[model samples]
Target chain A: SQTIHQWPATLVQPVGSPLSLECTVEGTSNPNLYWYRQAAGRGLQLLFYSVGIGQISSEVPQNLSASRPQDRQFILSSKKLLLSDSGFYLCAWSPRQGVTDTQYFGPGTRLTVL
Target chain B: AQSVAQPEDQVNVAEGNPLTVKCTYSVSGNPYLFWYVQYPNRGLQFLLKYITGDNLVKGSYGFEAEFNKSQTSFHLKKPSALVSDSALYFCAVRDGRGTNAGKSTFGDGTTLTVKP
Candidate 1:
């Protein structure tokens, strides 16, 4: 079975500080990875998605960026964080590009930017 | 563009009673609908999805969803509610044309509370 792991289950960062969140998937190779943010436990806003290594497509334009350094390793980073960047960050992985594929999500990271 | 709507902001039901969480979607091509559940301070869990074939698709945790093409809706339903079912539910949709690999637009989410 495939499992997704995210680091720093909870994080507290000061404003303007750097941010880094890592997501790694085990038992799967060349999986599609995605980054999503949920605000106030409501709607989900897609941040970025990667189909392969070094390829990323961003949905929302903000201070956030994502990278796929390896086949199953994805990272979300920011040079400087904003107060609005505080939210629950979720990492998801799907088998392939087909829409029929169901996405599997990680435990998620809670970032509190003060 | 693809979008989904979960009309109800909240739903309340008693244990052992049937429950329904409504969902509707819009897309240029065929719609691929999905249901997910979220517990407090946790990540969303995949409940079920509607790709093709049966209009009534059964999913995890004894939940099912009916795909009504005419109505453009895929509402999640459960015959009996459990207190453990109380959580946040989300509906998502995307154009099944293979254009945007796994991109889906999610609904605002509905809070379901099942009382014993």
Candidate 2:
């Protein structure tokens, strides 16, 4: 069975600080990875998605960026964080690039920028 | 562009009563719909999906969803609600055209509260 793992389950960062969140998937190769943010009282917002190593597509433009350093490793980073950057971050993995494929999510990281 | 809409902000039901959470979607091609549940301070868990074939899809925890193509709706249902079932439900849809590589759009989510 495949499992997705995201680290720093809860984070508290001061304003203008750097941010890094990692996600890794085990038991699957070449899986589609995605990063999503859920603001307070809002739905999930797709931040970035990676198809392969060094390939990333960002949905909404902001201070955030994503990188696929390895086939099963994805990282979300920011040089300087903003107060608006605080939200619940989720990492998900899907089998392949087909509509029939279902996505499995990780435990998620809750970030609070003060 | 693809999008999903969960009309109800919140739903309340007794433990023994049936529960329904409404969902509707808009996509250019045939829609692949899915239902997910999120518990307090937890990640979203996949419940079920409707790709094709049967309109009625059964999922985890004795929950089911009926896909109405004409209505463009897929409503999640449970025959008998359990207090443990109380959580946030989300509906998502992906276009079947394979244009976006299985990229999915999600709804605002509906909160289900089952009283004991």
Candidate 3:
């Protein structure tokens, strides 16, 4: 079975500080990875998605960026964090083939920018 | 562009009663619909999906969804509601065509509160 891991589970950072969140998937190769943010009332918003290594498509223009360093490793980073950047970040993975593939989500990281 | 709409922001249901969370979708080509449940302080869990064939799809925790192509709706339903079922539900849709066909558009989400 495939499993997605993310850390740190919870984070607290001061404004303008750098941010880095890591996501890694085990038991799967060449999977489609995605980054999503869930905010109060706003729901789940897609931030970025990567099809392969070094290939990323951003859905929203923001301070955050995503990178796929290895086939199973994805990282979300920001040079500087904003107050609005605080939210529950989720990492998901889906099969490369099959149109009906369903995404599997990680435990998620709750970030609070003070 | 693909989009999903969850009309109700929140739904209240008593335990043991039938529950329904509405969802509608719009997409360019054939739409692949999915339902996910999110508990407090947790990530979203895949509940069910409607690919093709049966209109009624059964999923985890005894939950089901009915897909109506003409209505463009995939409503999640459960015959008996439980207090543990209180959580946020989301509906997502993805186009069956194009290179980025795996990309999905999610709804704003609906909060389901099952009262004891």
Q: Chain A TM-score of each model, in the order shown?
A: 0.98, 0.97, 0.97
**How close is every model to the real structure, measured as TM-score?**
0.98, 0.98, 0.98
Model 3 misplaced stretches (Cα beyond 4 Å): none
Off by over 4 Å in 2: none
**Residue B59 C-alpha lDDT in model 3:** 99
Poorest lDDT segment (10 consecutive residues) of candidate 1 chain B? B94-103
Give the Cα error of residue B116 in candidate 3, in Å.
Answer: 1.1
Q: Please, what are the lDDT tens digits per residue for candidate 2 over residues B1-116?
A: 78889988999999999999999998888899999999987889999999999999999999999999999999999999999999999999999875664789999999999998
Query: What is the C-alpha DockQ of each candidate?
Result: 0.82, 0.82, 0.78
C-alpha displacement of A107 in model 3, angstroms? 0.8
True contacts kept of each: 0.80, 0.82, 0.68
Model 3 residue B24 distance off true place after TM-score fit, in angstroms: 0.5
Cα lDDT tens digits for candidate 2, A27-111: 9999999999998745899999988899999999999999999999999999999999999999999986566889999999999
Clash pairs, model 2 backbone: none
lDDT of 1 at B97: 69
**Which lDDT tens digits does candidate 3 get at residues A1-114?**
999999999999999999999999999999999999998745889999998999999999999999999999999999999999999999999999876899999999999999
